[model samples]
Target: MPKTLIVVYADGAAHPGDIAVGLASWARCVFVTEPADHTRAMEPLLSQFGPVITTGSAAEAAARLRPYVPDGLVTYSERALRFAAEVASALELPFHDRPTVGRLTDKWLQRDALRAAGVDTVRCHRIATENDWARAVADTGLPAVLKPAHGGGSRNTFLVTDVGEGLELVRGLLSEERPGLVAGGALVLEEYLPGRDLGPFGDYVSVESIVRQGQVTDIAVTGKFPMVPPFRETGRFWPSPLEYEEEERARELARRSVEALGVRSGLTHTEIKLTPDGPRLIEVNGRLGGGINELSVRALGLNLIELAGRTALGEAVPTPDFYRGRAYFQLFHPAPRRASTLLGIEGVEEVKRNAGVTLYRPYAKAGARLPGGVQTQELDIVMGEAPDVTELATIAKEVEATLRYRFAFADEPGAAVTESSVTGAELGAL
Candidate 1:
């Protein structure tokens, strides 16, 4: 008889597809999901492993799982981390406590904890009203970032270069009837670390690791492509192009950041910025790097989802080993435009013919209306690998030139349709 693993499934949960396959080989996996999520796409994938329990609230979900006596409780949903923590506590399963999860999930709390631990981080202030906004500008100065204290995916985040711009952006953000993901509609205004000198690789990289019994192991460093203005992530490449010294420095910062947040057992993703002086903390996540898990598994030859589950079960896990190669993941978005309809994509077949191309998923369908932000409007992603960086660059260029996205806007006088060719430089920032 195998041990049972309980998973909390929701919109932001670890990629359900990957988790389902990964856990099936290790344990009797049970999924606790909302009634809305137990639909056609998820139900069939999850049902293959074990029972799929549907409940409306966290309490109900926990009650349903109590009988299973799960050996581990896990979730990758940012919104469900606290709920999962509570359920794990009730089940006597391994997980971070609510307070620790709070520190990891909330940007303001995360910065406070890191700073108190003597880890380098930027000065930040909480803003909930007009008065709070004024104080933040006065305190943090111009060229700062204002974002939801509890947000993810760069949604509703703004970079204000002056007081007037900050005020205007905050006013608009506050006026929204429903600001999604901004807890209590509060904002965190923090000093901006100018990343101009980091060169084409950008000024930031994310450290991916797994923690067990308060011990952290550095797995890999992922290099980021330049973000669209105001901090929207466009793409990422791994293993980081940074030299050995810089990689070690960022890894150390990540370890300190995770330890300060009191993460005991699970996967951790820490984002750090390399300023002229040294590495500084940007944010820390209490879950696996979203969407990067697939790339990591292919490049590093490690099953992170399995590692996360095994760690929660108190099993001793081995340090990860990597194979030689370079891989990149880039998300395509319709930028500098609003409310456009996706018409079609071209050369997808040609891009797929390349041996180096591993995954090319297009989410935007013909007649689909795209929203305004990077979080909502990303239309597709291209992932691939090659023997080395030079070969990888060539592969990326071929894919970028081969695929074309077509769009149209109804508001235009003639409903003009447009075709944009994606370039490797734009996709990988090479």
Candidate 2:
């Protein structure tokens, strides 16, 4: 008999469509969602996976799902982890303890935990007022990063070169005139981990691991495209091109990091930066990493969504086949910092026709107003496969060359970047 699992779904790494497809054969998944503006409309589509349980709160959700007696519960969204934990505990199913979930969700607490466990030493302080600047800098030093203590997807994150700029940025973030989507409704100032330049690729890599009953199985080390300014991620690829020793070191640190956070089960995505000294911890994600499932399925022939679901249900699953099957990639086109209205975009047909380009997804239609952040303000994404990273670079370039955007800058009246100029992250700075 198929196990019945309750999935607390929301915005995050896992795409609802892919989860729906993955759950069709493995289990009877009842997707529980809150009554929120962003998710209310997706109920129809979510129901395709199984029954849709709509509740206004986590308590209500657990109450409603009690009669069903689901065998397990899972959540892909960091925002919904706490909710899922609550529901799972109510139903006597497996899930992370509240303190572990707190460390996973809160950046300040995670850093503190890593430091306590001797896995990390980066100093971090939560910022509640301007007075904390001196103390923050005293601990973290110059070139610090200001981000939400409980944020992900690099939302409302900034790098400050001086104290004046840091204060100004924080004021802007909290002010009524320019409040933005900040994770956890607060800020964290911490030391920035600089990386050795590995030209053509970002210095960061993530470890994909599946832990079962205190055993950590390290999978592939995922590579990245050099970020656009202000910490905007451009792209990510599977089968990271890290040197043999470095990859092993990364996997070891990831294992230690998760164990330090008391992660004994489920999937983990640990981000690490390749500094001159060694790989440093960049925050561990409790759920699937963004764009991981897409590239993993295409390149490695793995369906992580189903695998994760089954693992949560205590079903035995296969260890990942990490052979270098192929190189899969997703390069995002982020809107320029000042672009407000998307006037026009050129080369959609050309990009789709580009060599090795398998899919071209354009999110913003012409004339749509853009908020101009790192992740959410993305204009489009181009994905494809190559034999290796070296050859994948050529294919990615061809796809990039075909994309061009014309946008009206709201701050600068009548100013627009046309098809003739540089596109993506090259045209602007954070």
Candidate 3:
């Protein structure tokens, strides 16, 4: 039977058209869906592949995937990654080790595994009750971070500096509804280390290789931009901007963590933080890059999608190099307003006229109330590539300023968008 590539994802604010594009580039057939949007973004791209199947969710699409595709691989999205692993196991197809994937996804379990393997990491503990939380707080101390044991995207993350705050946070956490998590068994509490929040925080390297006869082959690194706290990734920059010495140090530490974790083949998106002391583990996702991988494909000039397909098929792989110069991504963040309608772009002509900006797009439409809180919004994303960060930042600010949305609060007297609290009125998230 011929091989097929399957990618799974949950419907949400934004459709991962980039993931669909990557899968379509390599697989004989591609499938993707966005249940919430009641929309599918891959109808055009999937045409190149043999057959493109669109359904409501990853699980629904999994049923339509042909058994002929003997193997599969998953990229960044947490829901898609786990669903792919489960689907692979059910189909009796070669897939990543379930235990390893579990450890990678759960923060507390990951710390335990690393400690057992003699890998250095921050102190962490798991709790499911008031008694457990108290014990964990005593052991880890005040100024701690609380997170769902198996959560992603920083949905319910809380930072507490004292026991009282911790208690309040715990109460709030217990009260809030979390819909995506399957295992409600545990919550993780860890010592919160205060330092610079690297956007993307660390490099999300997607090492692609084959484990043949117990030998590892093929490895590639995809550098990521520092991310904002609680899993909101601003963007990814390839070939890390670290000095040569720092870069070497980071690579060695990454190698140690990878070997310690026993990752033999496939792609791994590992995050490591450089502290005043040294590098500490920040969890690793056993999959290809999310936005970083896409930047890598363009910057590194590698066919990662195809490479992953070959590896899944048990084929040999080749080493790849980084793109010349630098490639940076500026994630669009809502400037700072609510209930805003995209009034249409104002300075687009001027922005497009500027050099170094390769692409411009607004993922949200007009008349949509911008979702508040530290979450992703379609209006917040404008992807562009440039030779360096300085140029990228300049162009990003210009584009951000140029793109305007009109917002009118229901309680306000008139249809006014300006704010009287601060200097100038704005409608967006920054």
Candidate 4:
């Protein structure tokens, strides 16, 4: 019988489509997801690969998955990481141990461990009350960041330029109902590190790696597009345009940061800021970088999800020569205004006709409600490949110039169409 792999599925999981394809190629794939997800779009898409099991809770999912005696267990959800770690432990399977997963998932714990290990990291404090928030500001000084201690997608993250803003944001967070991954009323306040003042690409970048048996192999450095501020990512460019020495320094920092966190085996994504002083860790993720799998496959000629699955199954992972090319993924957001309905998209055909264009996917449906001011909830994504950074920049500009979005508000009868212009310089390609 073929080996069995159990995947904990969630909406917005890192590379779910690619992960399913990767696992199904090597093992008998079984997906465990929420019942609601099963009834939604994910079910049909995932059903193409293998059987899916719907459960109400993580514990119940584990109970159902136990009988399978899965050879490997994996999850791309930040909320599911701890649960998956527990299930893996019960099954005696290879995984980043529970403690390691905790440190990776909890931003506060991550800061503590990295600092304790003498890793270069910013000072951060946990806030659960107004008093704690004031104390954090007094200690960390002005221009700090306020964010959930265990949150992803930049939800509820805010940049506190002053005490009043910080206090308001913290009070709101304290009163809001907490997500499963977050401790009730808990938030993290950290000293903000400014990135290089280059255009859209911030001074920070993400390092993607696959770790096996306590060894980490750095695979790629991904550059970021200028954020929506208060800390939401807009897009990313792969094989960062960093010079050889800077790239090496980043790799060393990533390896050290991962080692400090005690990650044994899994895919790791580490974000670090290229500060004027040096590289400092932002956070570490115990899975592939979100939206990076497809970019990796296109630029490096590697399937990160497959590599992660093979590592989980205790199989030898082969390191292949990466393709010497550049690729970028940009997000389109309904910013400046919210839309009650997405009427249509124009110039998609022209974008597809561009030589460098590879993938263009729109997430918004005709009747979908699009909330403004959040880049993380972008309505569409465009990815392309080119022989070098220059060509990649050209492609990005062309796509941005060609595509247009038409939206209608509840009070409006006619759709409002607008063309978005994004220049290469504004994209911040290093």
Each prediction's number of clashing residue pairs: 0, 0, 18, 2
Q: Which ten residues in a row have the lowest lDDT in candidate 1?
A: 421-430
Q: For model 4, name the residue pairs that clash.
A: 200-226, 201-428
Pairs of colliding residues, candidate 2? none
Question: What ranking of all candidate models by TM-score puts the best one first?
Answer: 2, 1, 4, 3
Q: What TM-score would each prediction reach against the true structure?
A: 0.89, 0.93, 0.76, 0.87
Give the residue spans of candidate 3 off by over 4 A.
Answer: 6-26, 30-76, 176-180, 183-185, 196-231, 322-324, 334-347, 390-430
Top candidate by lDDT:
2
* Native-referenced Cα lDDT, model 4: 0.74
| Ten contiguous residues minimizing lDDT sum, candidate 3 | 420-429
Give a tens-digit lDDT track for model 2, residues 1-430: 7889899987663777888777777688888886676677778888877888877676788888877779888888887887788778777889888899988988888999999999989879877766777888888888988887777777778888998888888776655332323322667898999999887789999999888887888767899988878888788887787888998898899999999999868889999999999999998988888788777778667777887888889888887655455788888877776547777778788888776788889888988987766544567888888888888878777766667777666565565444334555354352
The TM-score of candidate 3 is 0.76
**Candidate 4 residue-wise lDDT, 1-430, digit = tens:** 8788888777557545677666776688888776554336688777788778776565666677777778887777776787677666766777878789889988889999988999875889888688897779877787888888888877777778978877887877788787324558488999998776655356888898888889888888887766655566667887676777887798899999999999988889999898877778889999877878877766666778878877888889787553335555554543323344566667788888888877778877655666653335666777776776666666766776677665555435464554343332232111
Model 3, C-alpha of 99: deviation from truth (Å): 1.0
Best by TM-score: 2
Candidate lDDT values, in order: 0.75, 0.80, 0.55, 0.74
Could you give me the TM-score of model 1 versus the true structure?
Answer: 0.89
Instruction: Give the winner by TM-score: 1 or 3.
Output: 1
- The list of candidate 2 runs beyond 4 A from truth reads 174-184, 374-376, 412-421, 425-430
